[model samples]
Target chain A: MDEVYLFVTKKILFNLVSRPVAWFDRHIVDGFMNLIARVIERSAYMIKGFQSGRIQQYGYVFVSGTIVLVIIFIYIW
Target chain B: MNILSLFVLIPVLTCIGIVFTKNMKQTRLVSAIGMSIQLILAGLLVYLYLAERQAGNMAEMLFTYDALWFPTLNIHYTVGVDGISVAMIALTGIVVFAGIFASWKMEFLSREFFISLILLATGVFGFFISLDLFTMFLFYEIAVIPMYLLIGIWGSGPKEYSAMKLTLMLMGGSALLMVGLLGIYFYSAPDGGQLTWNLLEISKINIPIEMQRFLFPFTFIGFGILGALFPFHTWSPDGHASAPTAVSMLHAGVLMKLGGYGAFRVAIFLMPEAAQEQAWIFLILTSISVVYGAFGAIWQKDLKYINAYSSVSHCGLVLFAVLMMNQTAFNGAIIQMISHGLMTALFFALIGMIYGRTHTRMINEMGGLMKVMPFLGVVYVIAGLASLGLPGLSGFVAEMTIFFGAYQHTDTFHRILTIMATTSIVVTAVYILRVVGILLLGPIKNDHFLHLDDAKWYERLSTITLVVAIAAIGIAPLWLSDMINVSLAPIVNKISMAGFEFTSLF
Candidate 1:
């Protein structure tokens, strides 16, 4: 009886608490870093193309950057 | 001239003289002389305070100077020093004096710089001596407002943004502190007591528990933010990184101390009942800051950022030790403030001198500094050792006493937190060694730095003063501990007298 109770309790905690904590640490923390990495990469690629007169999406960069910053500030405030 | 008034008045008058000065050399000279005089006066004041304590006059403030100011709000311009206050006054003197010398070569707006610096010193001096809450609050703001111009104008690498963020965060903290102070004034005399701004008198009144609960968080978090309390400590790293050397020395060294001092003198001392009930919230956060800050420093390449994060770690100990609610821990807390102030000042001073020569702060980009600038390298080692809590240093005694007092508690949970805090020491040691090994040892990274000159004469003088002070306190802490414990006794008594077993609150 004791062994069964311990196993069940461990299962509940692992599913309920530990899983969420691990998920949050990865998705939220690493996801933010990954997103930042992606933005910088894309911007570098776009700038290189624009210097060669091949890319023409200047307006999108400012608009998207402003929107992201706005959302962050709103969350912060 | 009252001694307490001299502490404030000298700096004020010197600031005026600085404003009228025509050139940078004259400005630095005048401010340097003024700060030296303040240091002498502060030393004398500490001596007198100690004599009074020895003669059994531990009843109230040692030397209080009173005058009528702002009569409309029932506030009096009062100033005095207990054992702790006198010590802090001396700390301000040392930091400001050393700060002037450290910035001896500053050419950019040097006249304006010295003037603002001295003015800020006056406000800090006034705040430490104030017995009236209203006067204290006024001086606190006076100390804070100068940072905007100082950093925003003279600082480097995104100075304006960092300055604005620091000023806004600190002001928000003050707004919260104002609300708490007002609540205390309103609910002070629930039993037909008279209204007053005198802190000592207010402590005698039995504030209702409900009000204390509401007020304590506001006061703790309010001051805690300035002390670089965790979760709210983000501004400090950027601010310190952007600030000039002398500003970093003062900000990390003495200014952040105002937060810890205010938290203890006003927040915890006035509302012991609330402290008993709510200390756990602080302990958890402080423990996290201790560990988190250490981990944060481990990866930083910039010299100032590492020290800034280290400060967050060390300053967290001040709050953590205080919340232990034991005599030994409180003693350790005060010593930690003094210890950290001197050590961090020395560190920043050396960093400034070294960086001036190398023109780079990246650890990976510099090596064999001990070969070229041996004096700076040696002092950096000493400061880093003191920081990592090496035995026979000030940090060692402070940390040991804190641990001793912490475990004296009845609870096992706090011990677990204490262990976590203790593990941070290992992380601290690892990073300190890593930085030392990388920066001070091995061959020179760039031949450009091989011919670099070591610390100048003024820099040498500053290091000798700070190192001697650090060593003296570490080796012979008995006198300092006695003075601190004498003042701490009354606070512990008031808390114990509340008849609340603080651990039982859990």
Candidate 2:
């Protein structure tokens, strides 16, 4: 009777807890992190293209940002 | 001489002292002593301010001293501290003190490094106490120009490119701010009088609405860029990743708070009508920043990049709460600035220490650090928990007050935005725990990591100073909150007095 109890408690219950916990941590949590990383990295890469180290490109951004602000002011006022 | 000026004077004197030192030891020792005195002065200032408040001093600004510097332009070297500035000064003091110790081992041009670092700190101290716009702008530029030398000389990982990018972006922001300030100056006397460049003087008389509408965007976005608002935040991750440990700590901890403080003090307080009208546009941008930065942090494997992105998210929350324009939210904004400042500094310091030992910042490359370096690992966990807004931590107190204040707007638009902003909390928890599990727990991935030594005495001192501050705020937030809440009354009244007919952009 004691052997049966040990098998049920240690083997069956322990597997139930450890296996699921490990599975959840590995599959759900880690996979989610990986998936999000890929998605954001793609966007970050695209954004990086606009941030070329060229002095001319930076000038364009400054000019364009000023233009956008001016337009907003005109529209709202 | 006003006592406030000493905050800047001591740092300058320390730089002079460092320049005369013969060896690295004397240089750092002098720098440490100077900053320690500065920190003690800050505590004294706080004590005096509170005691004065207790003695029924209801003046808007305490300990003000104004003197003309540029008479032609009506610019003065004015200095004062209300409760808010006092808090910011204290934050700067603690971070700079810890920063001196954190870089005790710097060997390349050690004297020059310490001098530049103290100079940078001097600008920050001056900026906080100044009430005149011209002097504030002067100090603001003084603070920013040192980063190029700091990063390009001593930094790692694409240091040159990162430094150039950071300097140019910040300079661009300053150019816009200059235009906005000059515009405000031109309209300073709408009733046709002499123009002045004092913040309190400008606030006393309302700038005409047409001019306010035109200049508000420039001022807000100028400071907002530094506060890491959305697309403009690109420089932060790269810059922080490349900067040396102490530079990253001071830059993240004390410097970025400059933006939020300026936006609240100069942009919003002086131009309440424009802020009330145009709040929607900035609110959307800040909300995107709040959520997107959290998601961005989750993708980064490098420890510094992870923390830099988290700073974007946290600082974005500061701007968001400021825009809420209520006493409670404003109080929350100030607290968030301090909390984020301390924790992010701790994060950068820990990352530096860990990188120094393991020689790599990639999480996947290191594992089970707890087995070898138990002290740093445990502190890192505590920092992570604080950042994720666990109850009994500074993060929780700040975020809860912000959300509660924001939800007071009974309109559907605010309700929806509030709910959207609230989702970032869960994302923050996910990233924090994932890093903890991967970096501290699980099996040892590198056999070499087993033999690494734990934190040194100096490193322990730096981290523990920050940790104690984090816990102090977390455990007993009420006193700080009440102080901020009292000072916020006038600003909140000014903001609320503006008519609220512009909630919906469409």
Candidate 3:
């Protein structure tokens, strides 16, 4: 009777819950985070050469210039 | 001057005043006073709008000031507020006020700091009240510009890189928005009227369904980027994590909401057919973000990063509710915006205070803070509880309404998505509890943090204001809900445009 109970308990613990939890931890959750991290890494890569990014440095100039053009267009249309 | 105009002008003038201040004290005092006055004005506007709403003119703009600014293009200097704009304007007022108090202790280049802060605020006020497209976009550009300097000059940990990353991503969004606005302008023409940039006039000119579908993504993605829509949301965590406390407060609190506002007011309203058709795409993406952000926060050690990711989740819910295309859900979306704004602001404000004292934000490094700084701990608990959608807190009502309303209006697929989004609350609860348990309630793990001081006077003022605002809105949601319901009626009723999306492109 004791041997039978021990075997049943082991099967329930391993199959019913523990394995799925382990699989989830290793695959689903980790996989999801890794995918997000890769996307973030790729995005971060786009700005790696920003030490000399002139357009970004003086974005205000372009923005203001656009504003002036829009105003001019509005006035002269 | 019209009341709507003053909300913009006063902040601009105050920003100018701060630029010339000699010391931190004078600078803070001036900005605080200015924001207080702006708050009073916002309160007055809400009162007037509510009074007008009660008088049975709920669907129309309460007060409209229109002048033909550019006769050539028919671009007018127009401003007004329906119930929705009034609520948003009032929210901006409260957040900006609390943000000023949160930054009271900053002494480095204090003058320039306040100047930039108020300038950003001026643009936010202008954007909400704008009844003309040119005015709205101008304010939008102005609002986004100051963020670069504010973050780069005064932020911490990867500030420069974060600043650059944030600016570029937002500008990319702006470019898309510009194209969409211009497309609308060129396409719009009332039955016999000449092309105009006046929102009221353009609403009468319905574009072809095909054109609306084509233009939908431009406006949706453009504004959705700022709203921290999934996949495009990477900048937000970096931005919030690197920003100074007050800037973070305003940025996450109110600035991000501009995305939802712009998307609904412009994209969905202009292209109702597209909204109803492609809502499934939005439902899937937004629900994924809602769950994804909560899970992301679970493993994060940084307090600000946790909040940042949480924001992506909550803000996703805002857009999710918008795509529901129903009255209650739409109302709930606006309520979520306001509630999340206040709650997130409070969270950041408290985080800043803790980081100041503990010199660390890692939950593992902070153990049993409740015994040391009871006030801060208590408030943090309040904000955290609110975040997890506890009843009698602001988030609870907002989210509950969204779930109920969305389930009511949508079919099987959307219903499944709604249920998926609902599970996010469980995730949120787990993470919030983990942080609260580790940081606020546990055995003291370090001696150095034993006697850390509680919140300062200014900090207390900020937290108290936010706490009261949260509780009041949660307990008695009727007043705010009434305003949102009225403004949402036309949109929910499928009245495309209805003169709400005010920006011109041609």
Candidate 4:
């Protein structure tokens, strides 16, 4: 009885419930932060594409923004 | 002259006083005295405002003074203070006073620096008090124009590039704002009575729905960019990373606030139907700002850039709460503004002092600073805790109120967005703690770090003033909330009424 009980508790319960749970907990928590950080880093790359330090690029952006506003007001609205 | 006019006058006079000073000593001394006087006057104004409120003066604006400036265009120099404006003025006074001391050791063209700084303050004070859209815009430009010289002349790390970029982006925002303001002015009287730029007068008239729809975004986004709305927020991190200490303090602390205040006062208050119709779009944008800025701070190595990104996040929260458009949320928004102004000023002042001592801003390059410079290290920790929304801190109080108010909406969109924004608290804690652990704790990584001295008298004075204000709000938020709550009544009523009408249309 003791051998059977020990086998079930240690092997089945620990492996099925405790081990995977621990693995899941560690990976999920760590992975969530890393995933978000990765997403942000990727978005930042897109941001840097336009944040180019050139004056002409910034001007283009400004003019394009105004044009978009004009389109929104005149055409869409 | 109305006492409200003195807010602008004192700073102008300070600029004049700073001009005659020949050396750094005299220049800093004069600037300090003038700002100290301004701080005292601000305190007096708050007391008087409270006294008037106690005596049951439920007027919309107190201490108003009006004079015609352009008769044909119907422009006026109008000034007044509601509770919100008074709180903002007080914030400007405190930050400016602390900022003078933060830059006490500036020796390179010290007189010119002090002059430009005071001139910027004059613009901020003027902007807060102005009741007319024309003068308000004038003051807004006045506040913005000084950054070009302040940063380019005294800044570091591609100063010219940063200055030009900041100026051009803000100028773009201003151009948008100019169009929006003119639209409002022209539409001030649809029945074709005499046109006016006075805010109170304009609030009484209902602008046509189509015109409101057209102009609302222009105004909101114009101010939104300065408030560090995402995408356009690219200017802020670079500008802050390069500017001098006091300039960063004032710019981040008070100047960015102008965007939030103007959006609340003019854009939303005046165009309620449009704001109600369009709240979701800006709400999404502001949510992006809050979260994106927090994540952006995590990847930064430079100290100022981190704080600057964090400022974008906090200021974004201010706009987010404003869009909630309820009394509780509006109260939270104003408190958040004041709280952020104090907290960020404290962070920058401490960062400036640390950088001054170590001569480097990269967190990875330093360690175990608490052993050598215990004062700054401890203050930095407190600031970090505040940023992370620890209980009994200003950040916690402001954020709680904002989220609580937002939860009142009971709609799926608001609920989801609120949850999205709430995740930023976790991200904020991550970056703040990561920086604190790497920068202030652990073994000293450099042998020379042992020689570092703690905060000087002026540095201590600057940081302490801001910390006290932060703690005061954190501990007893009721009075401040009450003041803001009462003032938010008119704006909230307008929005709710507009909401009712919109539902009826549906």
Candidate 5:
């Protein structure tokens, strides 16, 4: 009976702590990893498209100008 | 001395002048000149308003001009500017001027287009200035009527359907507004007292809470529909997508703001108790508009449709802020109105430039556009960044204030609603970056686009002006915020005095 009580107490403590940690690992960490992976993949695709000389045909002037404007705006703000 | 009258008269007479001119160049020249003059007057008015504020009398309306139009009904042709009206008037002036310049290249029915555009501007200016409800409604309809012709006649792809949908929906809203106005008139008239539609006079009388409750939704929803509240907002995207560039810019930039301004001025200011009770409903509907609109934009392939959806989402933020019923939130709402107007105008202008060159708007078909027209691409991205509320942009400041103000309210439900609305910022980022990446950053798939040139000088001018205006507001919002706060203080005080408690949850 003494051994069984000790075992039950350990089991309750383990469940209480591990469940929240497990849930956080699954939802927060995993979700962040997924988001980062998606962003990286998208960036890689864009870089690859840039390398193939495809970006040359479209209006890069506008894109570059927009980036500069955004940077300047951010600096000022 | 007659600056307000000249602002309205110049535009009205210009419309008349354009209609009579058989030559397109002559009509264009006249319209441009008229716009230039109006811009100057607007600048003068803003300067005077600032001067007045500096002198420590910010509460009094500037450029007070009154003429009796209907003595029998006690209605007067009253036009004046508080800080809010002046800011809106300045917005209209800038947009109208830029719109004229943007449409300079149009070859189709230029005379008629300029005339209608000028007429629309006249109505907008009138709406902003008019203190009388009857005149305000008349000008509201005037501003709306030209949109039908503008879109239906000069628009592309299902123009008729889009125009009809927009006109019918807006007219339906106006009908409700008319009912609300009539209700106020009849209810306010004493057994021996004369009926009046004068806004200043009517506001003096205490409207019954029950009657206000009944009329608030009618008037609020009536005007809210144009502000692009959910479900009733279906017309905006379709209308904007089909309308010409200048029309799109004006409609999104100024006309939609009229709806929000009217709702605040007429409904909430007059019926404070009703507004307090029913604000949560607006909060819920507008939050849905913000979130759902962002999702809607993600699925759209057309450039105009994307911007149109963004407008719906951004404007939803304004309504959300208003319903928070606090000074900070209300101030944010006004700022959002102005920010969205400038940002969306920039978007439409850039899209118009691209559409002019490519003769197409499909995202799939547009790739690596940044390679050729770098200036246009960069401006497009800047506008996109602002739209998504990237920190330091006008959208970010406005949205942050709104969220902060909303969270202060003790109501957990409202706080949650605000949280839901914030998701739109993320969603907006997704679609904006997706479009930027796919359409502007990727490999140019079409061989035909290799020779595409940058935006023309006129386009450059229009775009740069908008960029400066947006940056000014984003970077140093204090000047504009102070102005808006000054105007909002009385309204906030009234709401508070009506016994609405604002408990700070934070």
Candidate 6:
């Protein structure tokens, strides 16, 4: 029974240390992969939106704003 | 110390006066009187130029004014005039006067428009007069910036977009030009001994061949964008399409010529060897502009677009003439500049009248315009004939001289390109005839066009002035050609000194 107790104690100790390390490895990798997939998906969606003319108004606004900024800079500088 | 500053300062002062004027009529009258005085002064300058030329004394520099503007940078407010500059000044005077008359009916923002117009003329006049690169650039930018406001505030049909595109493209070109100018300035002034932007002083310094090769394209293409060289020419048709009639006349008529003039005076003249080496490339691209712009106009529905593209094509011939790098071609270039100016101005003026009455630019919508406006129809046909290089018109003499000059070059490939450009003359005839046939010959289609009246007295007066000038140049080109040849002699000698032989064919 003492041997059995020793063996159970050793096993619990091993699990306590390795389980956290293993969990960390798995979750960390999965989180990284999920972040990459999210980024790629968002980029693809943005490109699709651009091709479908949904982004034109935004583009014009951005361009006009940029031009205004440039003109202001030129005027000031 | 010279009369040249008055060309710029007078208009600027008048524009300032216009700001204080109470009513539109007063503004118009003041602008007209100011321009008339300028015109007379320009005429006197031309007389001086001719008198100098006649006495076989081309070496004497007349009306030189110099003062230090930026001492640290060696930039001076230097102004001078030679024969070619005097002719260009005269051209500006005629166009400005006629443009003022053309815009006499403007009720909306009339004062503002005249102010910008006069300011633009001032810049152009200043550019032609200034002998210093920095001063010239200042005037160049001033001339170009007002175009955006003029077109945006008082224009039609997508004017804002056109204005923005034109301003951006031209300014982008100027960026390249600025880089080139600074590069030349620094390289030529390596000793750091009073860095100078004077054209004559810079020309005296022999720029390294390698550096010339690198900087040549920057300056040429940069200026070529304004000259409507092939790929950078897209802005022109759209800009001219949306511009007010007077703006279109001045912009396409004289402003575009400034580009060619700049390329000639600065790029080619400064780096003759580089220009010689790159002549083939310019020839190819300009040939394409000539042919493509003509065919492009044939497919256009709007009358303004047609004229716009034709200006592109006609201006291409000017670049092509410059690329030929011969005295005859150079003479042809000057003539083409003058001829195209008159022709395009007449075109815009006529188009404006029709648009004023019908409120549409689409040729398909209006027919039998000649039935209502016989006088306009005659002038329109004459202008069209001149544009297509008909034998009796100014375009014919210009194109023939260019071709003859280009043939003297040993490059068989360039000769073929010149031949291909000649085909555009035929294409121009096709499109011009097609436009006249569809609009003037067919049965009246739109009932709305029936109420259109003949041109008013002022319109007739302006049109007649251009028509007379076109006819005068076409019939007796020697009067202008002699002056152009006198100016081209120095350019040819400079190029020859760079080891490119320019043998006259005529």
In terms of DockQ, the best-performing candidate is 3
Name the runs in model 1 displaced over 4 angstroms.
A1-77, B500-506
- Per-candidate clash tally: 0, 0, 2, 0, 27, 0
Error of 4 at B311 (Å): 1.0
Q: Give lDDT tens digits, candidate 6, residues B231-267.
A: 6787797799999999999998889989888888899
In the range A14-38, model 3's lDDT, one tens digit per residue, is 3443345335533675456447557
Per residue, candidate 4 scores C-alpha lDDT tens digits across B9-100 of 98888888888888899999999999999999999999999999999999989999999988999999999999999999999999999999
**For residues B112-181, could you state the per-residue lDDT of candidate 3 as single tens digits?**
8999999999888888988787778788888899999999999999999789878878898999988888
Could you give the C-alpha RMSD of every candidate to the true structure, in order shown? Answer: 10.5, 9.8, 9.4, 10.1, 19.4, 19.8
Please, what is the TM-score per model?
Answer: 0.86, 0.86, 0.86, 0.86, 0.85, 0.86
Tens digit per residue, CA lDDT, model 1, B376-420: 999999999999998878888778888777777867879998988
Looking at model 5, how many pairs of residues clash?
Answer: 27
- Pick by lDDT: which candidate is best? 4
CAPRI verdict on model 4? incorrect
Interface Cα RMSD, each model: 9.3, 12.5, 8.2, 14.7, 17.9, 32.8
Range of the 10 consecutive residues with the lowest summed lDDT in candidate 4 chain B: B497-506
- Once fitted onto the true fold, the runs of candidate 3 whose alpha carbons sit more than 4 angstroms away are A1-77, B190-192, B496-506
Model 1, chain B only, scores a TM-score of: 0.97
The TM-score obtained by model 1 is 0.86
The positional error of residue B325 in candidate 5, measured at the CA in angstroms, is 1.1
For candidate 5, give the lDDT of residue B52.
84
Q: Native contact fraction of candidate 4? A: 0.00
- Residues A1-77 of candidate 6 have per-residue lDDT tens digits of 99886664345422443344334423563245346557978999888855555677889878999999999999987
Q: Can you give the lDDT of residue B147 in candidate 4?
A: 95
Cα error, candidate 2, residue A8 (Å): 32
Clash-forming residue pairs, model 2? none
Candidate 1 residue B481 Cα shift, in angstroms, is 0.5
